[model samples]
Target: MMRRVRAKKFLGQHFLEDLGIARRITESLSIPPSHVVEVGPGMGVLTQFLVQREDLDLYLVEIDSESVEYLHQHYPQLSNRIIEGDFLKFDFNKIFPDKFSIIGNFPYNISSQIFFKVFDNRNHVDKVVGMVQREVGRRIASGPGSKEYGILSVLLQSYYTIEYLMTVDEHVFSPPPKVKSGVIRLVRNEVDKLPCDERLFVKVVKAAFQHRRKTMRNSLKYVEFDHGAIMHLPVFDLRPEQMSVEAFQELTKLIEEHPLCE
Candidate 1:
């Protein structure tokens, strides 16, 4: 029997309780020997299923000190894999640094930020599978022209083949969330076809979505000072939301060549 841990609203704790769901989440990873990292292993509910796979190099990261202590006492074999810190602030390069896969029933509050973190380190991650709010999952998997489609969709799509794996009903979670949840799998693009500085790419994507209703010309203002070269872009009159991921890439290239910064 699993020991109960008090749900902390401040931490956004909604522990997954369904055993079948836990197994399904584990199976989704297609775990190979020496390949697994789970974030926010609350109560070791999912951890119980994950560590059983001898092939998996299961590791857990928990931020709640009490929960970490609880995990330590309950699962001594997993102690080496346990790291106590905010997964967002934890250095990916320092953790597995090289390429590895990650799984979790992530805290919904910082789920989007987690996506950004993974995007920033796409090169280091082989694949990422996690359950986040269903609405967020839709946004990440959203296509161009959908209301849900914006910077995140475009930015992530540029580097990954995102799949909307499955949706879990609210009942699956203990002290269930008001919203439905979903599982998403992101596999990093092996081809490095995007042609702009990673930093500038982020800047361009954020600027476009910052003023989603604005045209390319107006959006460029968020990132550019002088409009000399920016105005010359072929799609300057197009709204940022109307532009495709490729267009954003082209615009970033233009920004680089004419450097409004320099």
Candidate 2:
């Protein structure tokens, strides 16, 4: 018989006990047969359903040694697929030579960091389905002109289409988290290349939202730009929250064309 595995506080382990939600999350992945990496599969609640899909080449990345050992004993068939390491630091290029989808009941503490890594590897990652802190999920899937819209909204929206899937109550987990949870899906768009400087686009979006209340003209003062020229541009008058992903791309182009002197 399998012994009960304790949740590790430092690791942010809140194992999902609800099978219905687990099945729903597993079915959220729309990608065809390919590599699939599940992060922090604590106690293998969702893993059980994921492994059922023979089309997917399932792999689990768990940081907790105890949980990893438990998975090894329970799912002996996944001996080579179960990777024991930090998902943030693990090199995906080494594991998958091509694209893959990421799914999990992600750790609430490092949820944002996981998305950042996903964004960084956007080229090799086509789809992502995961559960995160409610606010974080809403923030990522939020569009322009909303209070939740910010850096992540713009950055992620640029390359991927985000969908706020479902809300999960705190009662679903073994040790209920203080806040509610949400599931989100991110599907990569077909933009082969960005119209403007991609790096500068990120910088501009972050700078503008640094003070979300301020208009683009005032918020982007720290960034190198010709204030006089850009002041007349319509985008400069609007707040960061008012601009869409396309608008931000346009703003970056304008700044690059007419740069300010130090």
Q: Which candidate is the best by lDDT?
A: 2
- Candidate 1 lDDT by residue in tens digits, 1-262: 3457778888888999898888888787774565577999988877888887887788888999888988999999988889999999978667674688889999998899989888877787778889999999999998878888887899899989899989999987888999999999988887675887768888888887888888878876757545774587568888776777887888778777876555
Candidate 2 structure quality by residue, lDDT tens digits, 77-105: 99999999999999998989999999999
State the TM-score for model 2.
0.97
Tell how far residue 147 is off in model 1, in angstroms. Answer: 0.7
Q: What is the C-alpha local distance difference test score of candidate 1?
A: 0.83
TM-score of 1: 0.92
In model 2, what lDDT does residue 189 have? Answer: 93
- TM-scores, all models, native as reference: 0.92, 0.97
RMSD of candidate 2 to the truth, in angstroms, is 1.2
lDDT of each: 0.83, 0.92
Candidate 2 residue runs with Cα over 4 Å from true position: none
C-alpha root-mean-square deviation, each candidate:
2.1, 1.2
- In candidate 1, stretches whose alpha carbon ends up further than 4 angstroms from where it belongs are 230-234, 260-262
